[model samples]
Target: MSNYEKYLETQLQDLDFKEEYDNLEAEYQIIKAIIDARLELNLTQQELSAKTGIKQSNLSRIENGNCSPTVHTLSKIARGLDKQLVIKFV
Candidate 1:
């Protein structure tokens, strides 16, 4: 591995760093999935906001996973994107 990568791996060996990294990675995955779905529908955040009647800023927050969207809000967003939201319980 490259020096930088090795350094990161070494740092991630710490419990706190590993937990934080895992959380961030999970958030990144969710955001990426949302962005990918939006791209698949060729809809920008503004377009999604217009269709769902949700504010663009709120959509931004949702994409960032900084804001938790209600079930109704998520349904609206999925409908705006011509998709459906599925939740699986483990």
Candidate 2:
């Protein structure tokens, strides 16, 4: 494994680190999904911003996990991508 991966793996063995990581897992998943979907549609942040009427800087922050987007914001992004937003408890 790469050094970073190795270090992360070691960190994950710690209970505190593992708990904190788990807490952020959902946020990470959301960020990854947004990024992946955008790429799959071949849309840049700027293009998505124009389509969604959200500022490109805001979208960048959302994609980078630097900010939390509300359900309303997420819905706008989904519509911009010609997608439907579905949230569920699993």
Candidate 3:
């Protein structure tokens, strides 16, 4: 494995670190989904901002994991991407 991957693997061996990492999994998934969907549609943050009426800065923050987006914001983003937002607990 690469140095960073090896380091991360070692770090994850700690119960505390693993717990924290697992807790953030959902947030990471949300960020990945937004980024992937935007790329799939070939949409820039600015373009998405126009479509969703949300600020490009806010979108950037969300994508960067600097802030948590509300369900309303996520719904807006989904519509802007011509998608439907679905949340599930499993």
Q: For every candidate structure, what is the RMSD over all alpha carbons to the true structure, in angstroms?
A: 6.0, 4.2, 4.4
Per-residue lDDT, model 1, residue 3, is 44
lDDT accuracy of residue 77 in candidate 1: 84
For lDDT, candidate 2 versus 3, the one ahead is 3
Q: Candidate 3: which pairs clash? A: none
Query: Candidate 1 at 65: error in angstroms?
Result: 2.3
What tens-digit string does per-residue lDDT give for candidate 2 at 1-90? 544347668988999989987999888677767877888799999999999999999999998779999999999999998889888889
Better of 1 and 3 by TM-score: 3
lDDT against true structure, model 1: 0.79
How does each model score on lDDT? 0.79, 0.86, 0.90
Locate the minimum summed-lDDT window of 10 residues in model 1.
1-10
Which 10-residue span in candidate 3 carries the lowest summed lDDT?
A: 1-10
List model 3 lDDT by residue over 1-90, tens digit each: 544347658978999989987999899789878988898898999999999999999999998889999999999999999999999999
* lDDT, residue 27, model 1: 57
